[model samples]
Target: MDIDGADKQEEKPVKKAKVAAAQASASAESAAPYPDMALAQDIHRLTMIHAGKLSVDDATSITGTKPEDLLERVMLRVGAGSSKPFDDVIKENEEKYKAIEKEEGKDVSKVEAKEKEEQVDDSEEPLLNPELYRHLQSTLAYNSSSALSEDQLKTLAAHNESILAILAEGVTKAKEEAGDMEVLHATMEIARYQAKTGTKESALAAYENVLALPKLSVGKKLDGHLEMARVCSFWGDWRQMKDVLEKAQKIIASGGDWDRRNRLKAYQSLSNILVREFEPASKLLLGGIATFSCTELCEYPEYIMYAIITNLLFLKRTELKKNIIDGSEVLQVAKEIPVVLKLANTLYECDYKAYLHTIVDLQPHLVANRYLQPHSGYILRELHVLAFQQFLDSYQSVTLDSMAASFGVGTEFLDMQLSRFIAAGRLTAKIDKYGGVVETNRPDWKNARYQEMIQKGDLLLNRIQKLGRVVDL
Candidate 1:
């Protein structure tokens, strides 16, 4: 019995040892950290460390991983030892700055402004650290689809020409490794650079590339269409310009936050399109005026002047005064931009010379604008024709030389312009070159009125016949 009990005790020890080994194995399996999870956590930690949101050691503690591999991966260099508090460092530097300012006897704001100007200059071609650049490059290669952040895109958009070249090169290299979406994004940036520095054709081609991309967002597509229209307008391709504007309007009508901005652009473009043809422009101008809010018009006062002048030229001043000019909002704005007021006074007074001079004085400013450049010649011609027609209303006949002198143009040029109007049936006159005189061809209003009445009577008779048929049924 004693021997058996001793044997059982020995077996008991062996069983306990086995159980202990199993628990230790379980514990190790539970504590074993995954390499991938560690790498991800370390990446975020490294970012925080670089952004100054976390001290290196603090990030290390939160991550519970040795950061040697992470530091190498990010290619970041940390100053040895604990970092001084950021605010304290800034405060110390500011004190030194103030001391230097005191010695120079300069205003603090002026000094700060000067420093900011210098910073702005430096920002034009900011130098990226080699280590950091390499790190970002590798990151973009690996995560091509998510290569750039919003902040990064803004920075790239704002960078100066020299820096844009560098960024463009980097993005091009990244394209090989990037996915479709990333490639699209990079393509957009490349195109913007091309547009800013290259020819309109290249920029247009770039924008077209973006449009061709699959599954693009509506806002992006809308932006692309608008840009294409602008390029077309820039080169005076009216047909192409109208097509793209139609495309953009469809997108805007579909509805989004981009509605207001897109509508504004549409109106601005439409204004440019009708610049030479004011009569048709007057129709569209009303819609544009109704579409824009008071705040928006404030940003684009030029468009406001356009709307006002269009109505005035159409003899719809009473209506415009009722809806716009007399409105509290527009009246306040008009007080600031008096161009429309001056133009109205000149037109109302029937002072053709003053009107011509007013347009001439404002022509340099208006014609210099990107949208208005193409229409400057047209505006002048239209005004000249209107002035001539008005001046001729009271005259039975006028010598070409006398008319040209009054209008500040050559007699031959005036006669040629009149010939075009006469040929087009726009002017009721004939040139008698032998006498150097223009004779008015008065129309018989009584006969024309009788023809108009007969046509209206025919239309009324048809409508009455249709009503009789309905009553009989």
Candidate 2:
């Protein structure tokens, strides 16, 4: 029995040893790979160097990484470090600079150091044409003011040929420093010079530079885009004009009071492009007309007028003849114009009759006045007349329901016109306790000015209304 018990105890010890060996083998197979401690230390050292806590040389020595490699990595990760880190680097560099200065201590400050640094000559050297520089500086200063003399502008233009390159460089540096207002003013002066000299390319380049500036405010950006578009149009670059107008549209669509002028200018620019392109006018007209109508409804009559005129011209030329057989199509296009005119007259609170006459007479020159160009006027006027007619024939008394139903536009749009009319004393509204209107005054057809506006509007309306007339079937 003792011998048997000893054998079992020996077998148990052998079994335990085999089980321990198997467990060890399994752990070795399943264990994760160990990280490189040396590599981890190097990375930590680089991080410290990047944080400005250690010099690049010290970091390199400690981590055993090459100085160039370490610096490349550091720059890649931290983007050349902060200004404070740069200042530290400069301080570190100063000792080496000073050692060179001491070694070349033969009054080297007086001599221009070609080896390390170039000393600036503080001595006045007649300003390298002092008269010209003074003139350029004065021109810059004058342009910065609200009103500049014609002679001053002329002088600036004359001297611009000599100093424009220098001025552009200075402006670029100023923009980089966030002093872009001065640069903008200087660029405008330069643009004027370019325009006067008929240097369309230079003018466009200057305007484009202004547009590319990142730090400009939204208003300035809009102005730049509009100006650039105008310049591109003058250059007869329709594709570029389209691009600038599309960008301007994006800016206008993003709802803001500050953008009103931009929105107006953008719509006008787009209208000109469509007039010029004379293709796909319908899609452009329908897509943006609603937004522009809303703008007009919200008291932006000029913009509304612009949109209406553009769409009217587009439809008059494109859809009027083709879709004349369809009553709904004719009515749909016709209804949009009068609502726009009614809103414009109501909002501006001017004599609608006088305004209509002025518009008709001035229509030939409206494009010229707006864009300061003569070529675009005639086409713009034709379009304006077409829109005026459509509005007259489709005139449903400017009631809330009629206005909404006629345009197939939203109630908020009609309400905008109502609000503007009420404000202008042309409309009186009866509102409930919640500021919702119960009733509103209908436009008086008997008023002399109203009748005249309608009469003048009819002259234009007659042309468009003829499109909807019964054909001899």
Candidate 3:
């Protein structure tokens, strides 16, 4: 009996050991995120390093990130001088392992990076370009009260050419040597410089070269693609911006962490906004508002405004009240941008005339916005259509003169506006030109379903008739 009891005790310890081992293996397998979560969220886009032609004060007001702090972040990416290669900070990172499966016979995380040389004090292609840095430093002196003189612009154009020539030579050498790290470093130096001081077309070409680099990890490639989207966005090229964002999405699918996935969502939302895809844009923007760290894309306050505006367009009354009117996030920033708040409240309160007038005043803001300027025409059109629909919703038919007076617009002017929207099928209403009345026709799901069923029935009857003829033959 004593021997049997001792054996059972030994078996219990063995079982415990096995269970502990299983738990440890599971933890290691699920080591999804390697770096600190905070570190992952702090993505480095060109916005952090360059403010384009804006002086320090102007850039600060526009982006809400101080130029000096942006410069400091730039120093982190590169160093104070030629002490670092453009990509040494990332390339020299310790060996990283992700438990991601190989796809298409390529392990994205397995790309080999060359070790950093002990002495990189004078790399042929240093991360910092003194010429560009001087320009950025000088911008701070003027406080952005005036634009640059033509002579200064000409000097800068020449300066950028000289720097590009030097960077290109280094890139050529790295290509000849077949060093992956050197190639990446050299290429990024050119890309970063172009993004900072050159034209949008030049910056885009440089980023395309960066993405074309061989054997870069998916993460690195995504960074390049996202930056390209930003460049395209700043220049108001939605077509290219849309393409870049699509490419970034595919890279994320192969392998990505939580932070990068969310970053892509933010970029996509902006694209959707520009394209007038308000539904998806509203969802993403509103959900991401609280935790939005993509300050490189826009300021936090700007993000909140987009969320409110988009939701206002897409959401029903209950949802608008729940999410925007009463939501703490929207309320907190609403007062700061009184114009946007007034726009939202007027619409919610059914003050149609006031809403249209406020939006008229708001048109200049939209037109001047770097991101929304291109779509300002379509946006204004949509806002007018929405107001018309809401105003006509309560009546089966209303005289054109009465409708125009209600909106505080002239009868002839309102007639033209309603006629345009009606023709475009944007408004669920019709204008009776002879009767001088507007008649509402809100969509009915049952009517649509009935029409679909009749179409299907006709198709089935034709098919049966053909089968009967074949049988007769």
Candidate 4:
């Protein structure tokens, strides 16, 4: 059985996407870059840079106002890996900033315009959410600029400062008055602003307060949790992200709107995958495939990749064929990355050897993903286990060499791998070393209790029925 598994990560295929992602929001005039999206883009490029698909120089060009910061982080040190020392770049940027400050000193025209902008009308329109601030900021910035520069940074810094003041004033004013609309919008502004522009700790803290507000609406409360969940995910705060997501799930349980429910699925699926919880992740990704509108965390095409990865890991052939092979949403992005469909078909077609190599090809992409990097080994290992088990289910007994041939691995290597997994209870087949054969002892007892892991023309179920008859006598 040879499975030609598809490589999930290909920076070249997504190169234009990455450049667009980085460039689309690459302006000093734009509202401050949403911190999570910015971090994700950098991580995407960093993995590409490390994997040789993207050069370090290209990465620098593709990243933020501080190319040195990303390069330094990429090399694990800005100065050590490249010819240029990081400290020098840091010094240069500082000096450049000081010179800009001196130039801005006499620039009263910009300041005067900014001052008027900050003097907000203090209207707490019931529907005027603080999240709209990010939407307005992102919209304004996207329309105005491309490529961040020192001047852009200065402008953005001042922009954040001005906006933060307005949001802070709104929050304080709402606190003094304590009306439902005023409190919800005011708190959301602080939470949403911090999520987009401030640190994770501050964002999480602000969100905590939002969720604590008695006057917060159900929809607004769920929004707060989801935003915090995204912030936690971007910062690699999985533990907190899990709690926040679970809380979101609870809120949605009491009847969230369609959009909110789907966004929760997208957010939870991403979090579950990062934390190595594949089962629930698979369900969420597969269920929310059609209604995936949560691009704030990731693009739809990228979301499809996650659905493919998780479902391929756990879905049985019948389930795989129905949900993925026949899935319209998964097929829609088929041309964008054929490998995702290729990988799924390889597994479904029972091409074990091809699937193994496909995983090998995908290793770089999996390892490069910021969210998937930590569990790269675990996911691959589980895929292999699924493949090996799928292979064994077709056999009552097979020689070690034959099984090895089925998977394109050496007999010795297969034996070693099988032994470890069998011992770990990952595989149900047992290796008979002296006989040079592996025998599967498929237990209907457990399968009936959980996964009915049977394939077409397999005797596992008949054997279970016979055993049940014997017990009845």
Model 2 C-alpha lDDT per residue in residues 139-192, reported as the tens digit of each score: 223222223244533543444444555445545654565345655554554453
Q: Lowest lDDT 10-mer window, candidate 2?
A: 3-12
Q: What's each prediction's TM-score?
A: 0.46, 0.29, 0.58, 0.65
Q: Score each candidate by Cα lDDT.
A: 0.49, 0.39, 0.59, 0.62
**CA error at residue 189 for candidate 2, angstroms:** 4.2
lDDT score for residue 302 of model 1: 47
> Which one wins on TM-score?
4
Q: Distance from true position, residue 331, model 3, in Å?
A: 2.0
Q: What RMSD, rounded to one decimal, does every model reach? A: 28.2, 31.4, 17.3, 12.8
Please give, for residues 1-473, the per-residue lDDT of candidate 4 as tens digits. Answer: 00000122122212234212212221112221244343354545554554465445544433322433443332221111233343443344345333333323233445334533642311110111123223323322322222233453454445556565666766665557545665565566567666655556777898788789885667767777777777776656677788988988888888767767767777888888877788899899888777666655766667788888988877877888988998877776777656567778888888878888888767655644676766777888988888888899889899999889988999999999999999999999888899999999887787674544455335777888899999999
Error at 217, model 4, angstroms: 1.5
Q: List the residue pairs that clash in candidate 3.
A: none
How accurate locally is residue 193 in candidate 1, as Cα lDDT from 0 to 100?
Answer: 43
Clashes of 4: 11
Instruction: List runs of model 1 lying over 4 Å from the truth.
Output: 1-187, 231-240, 250-277, 290-299, 308-317, 320-340, 351-353, 387-450, 456-473
| Alpha-carbon runs more than 4 Å astray in model 2 | 1-159, 169-180, 183-189, 196-198, 251-473
Residue 189 displacement (Å), model 3: 3.6
Ranking by lDDT: 4, 3, 1, 2
Candidate 1 lDDT tens digits, 1-473: 11001111100111111111112222122111111112222344444344454455544443344444445443221110113342343344335334432323224345444544533222112121222233434532334332334454333334334444544554454455545555555556546445433344665786787788887877667656655654454333555666776777787677645344535353454544444556666655555554443221123344556655555556444665565556444554565357556655565566655676777655543432333334556655665566667677667899988877766678898899899888887778889999999887767799999999999999999999999999999
